[model samples]
Target chain A: MLRGICLEVPPGALVRIEGGNGGGKSTLLRLVAGIDAPTEGRVGGRPPRTAYVPERFPVALPLTALSYLTHLGRVHGLGRAEAARRAAHWLDRFGAAGHARTPMAELSKGTSQKVAVVQALLAGPDLLVLDEAWTGLDARARSELDLAVAERTAAGAAVVFVDHDPARLAGVSDAHYRVEGTGLAPVAPVAPVVPAVAPGSRVRIRAAAAPGSVLPPGLSGRPGPDGAVVLTVDAARSDEVLRTLLGARPPWHVRTVEELP
Target chain B: MTALLRYQGALLLRSQRWLAPFVAYAAFVAVGIRPGDPVLDSLGYAAAGLVPLAAWLVRICVTNEPGAARDCAAAAAGPVRVHAAALLTGLAGALLTGALAAAAALLVCDRAATGPGAAAVAGALVTVVCALTGSAVGALSGRPLVRRRGYGILAAALGSLLALVLAPSPARGAVSALVSGARSGTAEVPLTALAVALALAAATGTAACLAAARRG
Candidate 1:
């Protein structure tokens, strides 16, 4: 139901699409991916090789993750042996190698999402369309996808992605567009805020977790002299680390957070 | 195209959807063989069975597309290529079924055949044609039975069966004629029906590809 939207994605650029719920984001991606044709105005210059990662992965087919990726790789014109190699490579890259033999219907949400991203990246598509593809990934895999996006653009491919996080690709976006009122409007870019600190400056946070409880992912900590967990984190990512700790299942209760002199 | 064909073949094999249907259809055709009937008669039964097998394949390949695969491959391979691959995969399945039916007919149901080898060839051809016709009709329908879930595929199979069975078509009789391996008269289908089936396969296959591409 897009009304008036004119967008240009140049080669070697990263474009981000932003919109609230039901703002025609997915529909626009569909049309851009050539899955749906535009009704009135024409869409021009779509590359011959393109790949899309939908927000939801359809995993009911009776296929293993590797088998599905191999099929799609072949669909993108890779030979059998090459397709199998890339399938296994990408699965391993995304930590889904263990699930290569697992049926599509049996994968967990995070692992299934990894397979979804792997398939899109398998053939090195010229145009990559991602619709909230980062929603369910783990921290490492999510950043790995960040690196993957950078690598795709570096290789002269255009990437269009929608992620729920505003902080996503903060400094890397070549252009930003917002979906509004049945169409799209360009969003003015804002300079990223990088809090200047001494190169060696670090942040320390002390917390207490229940006995035998594991620390949350992306946070490293050890027991202090008083038995409270003393966590050391890079000053830049301290907030994220702290949030992750607080958001842990058992909830690491912070006793103190300070900068070590 | 070759890679896509191979990919599809591998995907279909991995899915194993064809196993149950193939086994069931084979058993059904075997049971229908009367000991005294012409070995070629079983071919008609096999050809008839091929219609459902083909329709079922179409349902699996065309109707049950993964949203991720469909979207991801659409722009890369184009809808035309993707849909063609799926339909061609169905064609491959049909050919395999046809070959199997031929072997079974020649081995277990050989009575009126002039030569086992010739009868086998005729049986395979008729089976393949019936399947092509079945898949073409389903592709042309433009309705993806997957929208209906369990009932959709069942409905597609039954509907194809009905269209093939009730049309007073010379298809079944024509299969019998071809498999009879007579050197002269009535050994082939009327050119009109053959022409129609060929045209339908071409036209409807292209249309089905377009329809699949257009779908969300």
Candidate 2:
């Protein structure tokens, strides 16, 4: 039931999509990952080299874990020996070395999830779309995943992941947006109240210098019900406001607050 | 084409569990057919009968995963022609395997009467036809329209017809005519017919690949 939702994720950033079940969170991930198309609206962006791990693990055949991973690498255009070597290395790192030669079907659910994670990581894609990727991992495995993701981001890869446990990704994510009613709205930052200004009271603004820059066009400031001024500053005048505000002497307090629409 | 051949061959070898039993059954049928002056006729019949079986195997391989048809479309390979070449190569392997089984049976029956060269050529030709037909049918099995009762009816009718045509016949004129024609060194029919069949098969397989690629 989604409609006309648009979002732009910047390069080299981690985006966390949070929402209740049956709310199209997975659908959005699938669309972004290029696994599915949007019913309406156009999605435009560079087709980032991406790897997607679905909520349900898809293991091809009953081949050994190493064999399957190696095959996946080859499918993605990796050479034979190099694919094998990389797969082996990741398997060992994910504590799956002992089961490397074992058929994938024989592995437990948690073990299979570990293999999926290593496969996605080994691809080293420009974007990683994960759907509940942390569902069945042990604590150590989870830590390894965090380190791996951090390393990827440091090396300039973007990631979008969906997880039920928000606490696990608290500090790792750069931005978190919840899917609500076919659209996304940023999670507003909590603002500290200014006790100095009473609600419903009008304050006169002393010239303070006869409007040094004529308050540049398209720059308007209005007070909200909570007595906080919301400034719709034009991008061209943003630098002017910053210069004027920051250059002011003591007794002047400036706090930037973002509002959710 | 090389990649497709190598991948299909590896898959075949790894999934030897089901194929091994099938190969055994084919061997049993090949041996059970008695050898005599009518052996060539019997072989022609047997080769034709194998068409449906070959088709079933191809169907299993292609449709093993419900999503495979769609996945195949999305593969980042070059043109659809390349995929078509690969599929044909894989089918060739399957056909060759069947031909080998038939050749083994012919060798065991009467090496003196059935020269190795003739057996090889005939087996190869028959295998090629069966393999192509089988692959085409298998490809259709994944189509929504064919997945219905229509495909079932078609399969049953085709299977029954092949079995009947391949059944041994000791009839006089047509059988004698074919045998004499085969021996008279009139190589044109078999050679030309095989070449034409192979060309058609390649074209059809290519078409299927292109369709899949476009859909993907």
Candidate 3:
């Protein structure tokens, strides 16, 4: 039973939701996805093309994966051929294209999850809400979903997700909120964690913007105690991120630069 | 809306959940109507059988999708729309069954009692009235309204029984008109009953759709 909760997800933003079991995180996601209407107050600005993945995909539907996704794509307002094309593409991307003709009930758990994820991604929705959507995925599919989330946000869509894994999309999320006892509290964004990159290949930059000045849209990081921000970027892109910071009007002051061993 | 309907229709068809109610309706028609039966009486019996069959079919469609799949569809298309689509699919299936039964009765029953054309038209209207009334019972008996499978089925059975026997029910009025018309050897369209059933179904559908969104 959440109350007095207000969240705004801007275009291209990735919002991560954290909470204990039965903390209303799923409830909040459902409201955001427009699956369940709030009894009080209002959830506005929901795009018509919103898609959601529920926490569990334990279904024994008679439909084959491809047909189900195609139907969902159509429900999302795609033409039949276009819907089928996109469904096949997403299925293949998730490595479940081989199971396209298999009945959903006969598919393995991981494959069923892939189909669930594919349905949401196929339509390219403006708002994507996921509740523990990666729970049953294999390692490869999990990373694929991470990439899919990144791609969605990169394409200027708002993505809201809840997962048991704290490290999932840790650094890439634009904002974090915890549902605590019927109220929402914002948690400071964490430093980006790029798992594929070795420790030696990462760079950390510390900078502080002038008071009343906002950071560049492309730069995101954790807030330091003294009002400074620490951004961790790929070593290759550190120079570009720094150039944007220093090149701004009344430019940010770069306090320190370091390489992690 | 069309897409939703198509998806729901596919779910109904592919799931094979339609078999039970459909076979039940067919059995009811086969047992109640005979080749030598009066045309109007047989048509009335066939239409009356549709009330329970429609209610059962709507229940199946409304609850066919698992919770997670339903949520997915609800998110893609609003929950109200998903619920409405399920209701319409079940109603459409019931209507189709009702038409087939009525046509079979027109073929086998003795048509000498009344003009075949008028009887066919009247049977079609009466079929519509019963199907709409059954749909109303169905929409109110499933999912958000009843929730429990045992209680929902019980409600549907009782609701269908009441819709058939209760004097105020549009289905009852329409079926009675057809049965009495068999005696008078005349066809009655039951237009007023049809209007009432339509309104009843619309109200029931609106209530069910709102409940789906709220309860979800």
Candidate 4:
């Protein structure tokens, strides 16, 4: 039970909640999302439109992904035509268009998560609460979600999220807090990495490819200032990306594939 | 409220939350009624047996309160409105069941001048009462009993049975009076009993709101 907790999510802010297992992170998100009330505390100034994505999707419901999303959109007060449109848009954005017609129970875990996340964003809520929403997404879907979060914050929607990875939203979150004991305490932001070798156990590679040639779907990084492009892949998938880069008809010239310190 | 109604209608349809209750209602009507039987007796017996099933439906709707849906609704509509939506859903369920009962009455009962018509109307009202009361009982006991799904359903069923027993004019003195051909002429409902049912409904609604509030 959370007690004496005080929270203020400023408009347009991206707030990251950090804590270990059983540290009350989910409970905090639920309270903030208004899913539950605190035993003793006042939640002042709740915005009119709010959306929440829970950690677990209730997939046993007898609804197709599109129907579920449309139902939620309507719940948020959108017209049927508009709700249907938004549902399609978000499903396509998350690369789950095929599963839109599939029953929620039949979708893969990753697809189900995509549906869960898209439903929260369809109405463009003033406050969005997400609890471990990124856990089961593919790399491309993850990046799409990252971009969506940035877009929402840019459009002045406050976002509260909990992701296991510490680097999930590095350099983007406006505020961070740790849930401990019974309440929230501010976390000092970590300094940015501005070195040639970035921090982490990620596999980083530099390759020479034609300018503006799109990187593979699962890799994330930047285009270069000169000829070589830099990208990072999850250590588990490093070999997969490397083979794709080397085995292309017009193969990309590989420079380095070193483990980040 | 309109938006909530539409959304809820969609959920009820696609999720098929109505299947169990509707099936139970239909089965009760179909199996119990025979041609040339007194409409009231058949209906009353069917309704009595239906109490537990209807209460189970209400209990499922009000309790457990799907975490994802509740979270989404809490942020948008607030807990008060969410409970209101649940109340609305319950009412709609009652009305639908009432309509179905009316249709059954029309199908089974003979074309009498006035008695059958009155009986049909009475059947509809009792149907609503049974539904609303069962829904109310579910709301009253659900939050406390949610984890024990079997117990919650049983409690709702028992509570609803108790309410029904007290409801008939003994309350159905109102319902039975409507039946057997309104022997005296004017039909007078036991206002005190109705007041009790409505009050229970209101109290259960309030409890549902408090449950949402204390869910943390």
Best-performing candidate as measured by TM-score? 3
**Which 10-residue window of candidate 4 chain B scores lowest in summed lDDT?**
B181-190
On residues A93-147, what C-alpha lDDT tens digit does candidate 1 reach at each position? 9888999999888999899899989989999988999999998899889999999
lDDT of 2 by residue, B1-216 (tens): 344444444554565533753675476556656665344544454455455555555544443322421232122222243345445544665576667656655655544545556655655565555555555554444332144556754763464354335422111222233345445532112544455445645665666565544332
Name the TM-score of candidate 3: 0.86
Instruction: Find the 10 residues in a row with the least total lDDT in model 2 chain A.
Output: A203-212
**lDDT score of residue A63 within candidate 1:** 80
Clashing pairs in 3: A171-A192
Report the C-alpha lDDT of model 1 over B165-216, residue by residue, as the tens digit. 6644435445646645343322343344455556767787877676665664
- Binned by DockQ into CAPRI classes (incorrect, acceptable, medium, high), candidate 1 is acceptable
Q: Kindly indicate the candidate among 1 and 3 with the higher DockQ.
A: 3
**Model 2, A48-91: lDDT tens per residue?**
35676666554455467787677666555667898789899888
Q: What docking tier does model 4 reach?
A: medium
lDDT of 4 by residue, B1-216 (tens): 677666665566666767887787778777777765566655555545445555665555554245565666666667767766765675577557756665665577543434655566556555555555666766765653354667766677667667656634222433454454433433233345446556666777777777766772
DockQ, per-model, please?
0.48, 0.05, 0.61, 0.54
lDDT tens per residue, model 4, A46-98: 68788888777756656788987887787788888999999999999989988
Estimate, for each residue in A1-261, the C-alpha lDDT of model 3 and write its tens digit.
Answer: 999999999999999999999999999999999989999999999888999988778678889999999999999999999999999999999999899999999988788888889989999999999999999998798999999999999999999999999878987889999999999999987655545555458888989975556777688765555558888888878878898999877788999998866
Which segments of model 3 are wrong by more than 4 Å?
A191-261
Question: Can you rank all candidates by DockQ, best first?
Answer: 3, 4, 1, 2
Those runs of model 2 whose alpha carbons end farther than 4 Å from true positions after fitting are: A1-11, A18-24, A34-49, A58-60, A168-261, B1-11, B24-33, B36-43, B63-93, B105-119, B143-216
TM-scores for every candidate against the unseen true structure: 0.81, 0.63, 0.86, 0.79
